[model samples]
Target: MNLPPMIAALRHHKAAVTLIALQVALTCAIVCNAIFLIASHAQRLHVSSGIEDDALVWARSSGLRRGDGADARARADLDALRHLPGVTAVAQVNTLPLMGNDWSADLGVTAGDAQPAVNGAALFLGTPSFLGTLGVRLVEGRDFHADEYVDYSPFDDTPAPPTAIVTRQLAAHLWPGQPALGQRVYIGAGSSQGALVVGVVADVARSAISGGTSDHDVLLLPVRTVAGPYALRVDPTHRDEVLRTLPAALIAQDADRIVTDREAFVDTVHRYFHDDRAMVWLLVTVVGSLLLVTALGILGLSSYWVHQRRRHIGVRRALGATRRSILTYFLAENMLVVGLGLAIGTCVAMWLNHWLGERYEVPRLPLSWLGIGALLLWAIGLVAVFGPARRAAAQPPMWVIRQ
Candidate 1:
């Protein structure tokens, strides 16, 4: 329990102690940031698309050739899929969540303003039944009526419809603390022509998952486009059977067009976030490895010190130092080294986090993680040194003195 003697003993082995402390410091810094990265990736992978992922399937088709009537063919294709066994709902959609292809537009509160209110928002152009097909619930206002649905084409010169429904997230961004329903939001920058926000849906994610607040930023327009992707909702129990036969059914309706990229909504999400999942596991592996190496460093140094100071320990035991005292001395010494490392590592962790935040837009690391990391490393140090400390304590004073 005495301080001066332990301090003097540590001073004699300053180089080894400093090396171990530095190892612990690096471990703390890297592990903390790695954990943050892993958590971020996991959050991204688990983000809600706000759709009935298991019950839905999506497929893309090339537009009809010159001889084929694209609109008529598309309608027939949808009708055929709708009649398929176990298919409940179908809608022509421009984009689906986590597809990586996004239709975005800048929103402005005032018409003809050079600056817009929100720079980027996911735009979904579909029929009145689009929300129903995706199973997105309406939190406020009502769905678009059949009369409000407009036939529009992306390849044509027609502008976007004047009526729109928005996600709750977009509504909040456009009009904070106010009812988003019955409000008008300008569509294009510097254009007074805007769409009235007729409805607010619970939540719908964008096509691309950016892992930001904008993930749920969506603007839905009741504009029917025949030449786009199609989403179908099927009975969950019959999803696999429906998925297999649905493609042939669509193609049967339109032999001229190709039904490509058919996939379940859940599968699409998984494929989209594949890299994110991999990154999470990779960072977890790195954290585990770093902690293992740090523990090994502490164990190696403690064992070496015990071996080198066996005679010194025997003399202290002869001078009435109890086994518990010897063990406590070793543990206390390891704690002092670990504490110094933790102090330095905390600063290093913050600095590293700041750099990552600036470069990668990651959020600042929380102080709680620092505390957790420090505690984890402290426990590791104690456990790593315990074996050596026990060996030192069990050394017979007379046997070592005679040797």
Candidate 2:
């Protein structure tokens, strides 16, 4: 298409053109980054905790005081919960996924106060039914034998757990190519307390997301003690019923216990990711609002330009510029304007990502998203100008003579 006339017209309207171009530039830059952030939030929300979250529920209490009576009450409470309708498995647990980061320890291969081979693996001390209730699949080896499960005690003389189950990520981190099963690893970076790797599970998330592979590096020890919050596996359909009524039942069953908090495991996951969900919606709103404003700006400018240049368009039609050519002219003009904005915006987007990365450690927005954003803006600009372009092209030859 011919460019000289369009260039001359743009020069005559330099201030308006510059203003709209700047708007497009900012929109392009923001949209790219906003989309990238939305995607990041989405990924975080969907990251697997590797537990059967849907079938689980946990109830915390002012119960489970440490003593034989407390232990008997805890066991009785477990029995009461298990016999309740729809409960498939039950265990007393210190930590649960999306619950909180209650404890973490490092494990060393050499086993004598040497530097830990794996850092920040969350420790789980649950009953014999812990794996069954948590619903983590064993990828290799076996669950702790019934005899292997021990009562949890702060004063136990055992140096370390006799057996442990590890996540696949943790296994790979410590042993690399070697099998993690049957490998003896130290419990802490400072102690020679040794534990045997009897089982390897696919994944079980740490109590908290640490934004690293350490989030998957969990160590499960078989400690058969009833205390603290209890993890229950039930029919998914029955989870709500269990969550709602179990607390009341448990409270009524014993005078020593009082149910403090009750929640479905899936609901806990949602609550844990509440900030990510909010950010996703916020970015979506910002992107939607900016695109709406940009489209309206293009539409308004094209309509006004058509009105001001009426005589010029009629004269062009009289001089034999075809209707198709007139439409193409307006469309091409908008493309050129938006293309300039996109070029400027690409640089701005990169700079914005760099700035964000430095301050927030946000990942760089990919080049592909930049290209996609440019194409989207190009299409929007063409669509916005189409109606005014058609009106300018539709005037009859006699209309020019009358004017």
Candidate 3:
């Protein structure tokens, strides 16, 4: 049961012991980070887009004009889409959750010469029906009145919107511990006119933008986009029915220029996160492969050690050492080496995480993962050493002495 004799025996084979420890350390660091990334991607996949995913469908370019007629066409199309049998509400907006259309803005509490507090927020330009159409829950304040809606053209002179609605995430960040209602925020740098915040919604997901940010930061302007997708809130059962005949229905309203295929909002979400889904599966594969290789490495090394020490094992058995004692000795030796590697690997894992954070914006590795990695490796080492230890114990002292 004494560790010094076993430790001294290991000292004679420093090169082999060191190689095994270093291999374990490197594997622990890489595997820990890989598993962390897999978990992160899984979380992203399930994040709420905060839209009525099952009840909404959208279409784009159902009659868009570059200049004068764009507004009229949008108007006529909106009226006709509103009259569809299964359609409950319809509105035109610049973008929706997971639409892959990136439009961001910088906004803050003041309008003067100071750096803004909120940045990289998804900027949405929508009409009065946008809130109803998207089905985002308005947690506080009121929706824009019909009179509050204004016309906007990207190619022409478009006035700043008079009112704005913000997500609950952005509202809390900008005005923490206070009411967001009636607070005026400057849209851009040095804008004397402030866009009044009239409402706050529960949450809304955003597409990836230039600077990485939480996808909850979104703002809605009351300016109806002249060129934008028409979002229709329809019955869940009627999603396919609506997508089937929406084109012909738009043609009936004379907005029949460049009408793309109508699609459910949920499909847009799936398409947007295609890369993330792939990365998750890839990371999972890497983790599995590493664990398998590490287990096999331990098994091979233990078997080789038992072969080299056969005569020593036979001498102890001739002196009346039990089979259980021989098995315990090999297992304890393996644990000693693996424990040393785990200590070194903990430091290596943190260093790896810091480098990843600086290079790829990965979050700091959680401390719990170290414990998990150690426990997993410890269990693997025992199981791997058990087979070799049993084979060594089964050899008779007479057979070994004759060899």
Candidate 4:
């Protein structure tokens, strides 16, 4: 339990001790941040799209010959898609969730306000069957009536419709304590008139995932539009057949229009988050490898120390140092080294987190994660040094003196 001798003993091998401490420090810092990133990515990947992803498929068509009545062609395409076997509902939508394209509007409580109350809520334009097609549950209010539907075009300079549907998250954000229905929120930067929140859906994720609570912030407008793409919900048992046949059906409706980007909704989501999934696994692998290397480093250092101090251990054993005392001494020595490394690692982890937050928009490392990382390293250090300590404790004083 004496500190002077152990501190003096460590001083003899300061270079090795310092190197191992630095290695442990580096491992601790990276593992903490890596784990945070992995969790973030995992949460992102698992975010709810708030739709019938399994039964949904979307297709896009471009290269349409101008003056071929593009709007009429879009309507015909929708009709054809709807009539196809296994099709439940189809709609022309401006954007689908997780497709990486977002049409957002600045919303204000009052009309013509200079600053927005909620910024970057996704704007979705679709037909009256939009909710039905996407299978989004209505939590409050009512869906857009067929009479309220408007024909919209991206090229049109008209203002947005006066009636809109909002996600529950956006509704809560816009009106925290009040009923969201009948609440009017203005859109755009200069618009004086606002849209009434006629409906509130359970949830709808934004097109691009964000760090804030705005990930589920969305507003829906009942407008039949061909500016983006078409989404159709079909029988899950026939999803593949529908996907395979729908493109040819649309092409038949208009050969001039080129069919592009046909895939199931779930597949599209998977494709969008493929890189995030890879990063999660990659970070996991790095964390595992780093911890293993740190454990081995601790084991190697403790083993070397045991060999170097064999005679010293024998002398201590002769002077009434019990086996338990020898074991406790090595464990205490490792605790000191690990404690120093953890202290350095905590600071380095924070600094690295600050850099990551600024450069890559990652969240700050939580203090709790640092504590967990420290505890994990401490356990690793103890386990790694146990065997070497046991051997040191079993050294026979008589045998060492004869040698």
Best by TM-score: 4
lDDT by residue for model 4 over 42-148, one digit each (tens)? 98888888898998999888843335587677788889999989999999888998889998878888877888889878888897698899998999988888877
lDDT of 4 at 294: 97
The list of candidate 4 runs beyond 4 A from truth reads: 63-68, 153-156, 401-403
* Model 2 residue 13 CA deviation in Å: 1.2
Residue lDDT tens for model 1, 1-403: 7789888999999888899989999999998888878888888877888888999988887644323476677677788889989899999888888888988878988878979888888888886588899998888888888877787643455665778889999998989999998888877678677788888987888998677788888999887554468899999898888888977887787676676678888999889999998898899889999999999999999999888888888999999999999999999999998999999999999999999899988888999888988999999999999999998898899876666
Superposition error at 221 for model 2 (Å): 2.0
Shift of residue 305 alpha carbon in model 2, Å? 2.2
**Local distance difference test scores for all models:** 0.85, 0.84, 0.83, 0.86
What lDDT is obtained when candidate 4 is compared to the true structure?
0.86
Candidate 4's TM-score reads: 0.96
Segments in model 3 whose C-alpha atoms lie over 4 Å from true places: 152-159, 209-213, 254-256, 394-403
Residue pairs clashing, model 3: 62-255
Best by lDDT: 4
Tens digit of per-residue lDDT, candidate 2, span 288-360: 9999999999999889877777788888888899999989998998898988899999899999999999999
How many angstroms is residue 45 displaced in model 3 relative to the true structure, after the best TM-score fit?
0.9
Stretch of 10 with least lDDT, candidate 4: 151-160
Tell me which residue pairs clash in candidate 4.
none
Deviation (Å) of 302 in candidate 1 = 0.5
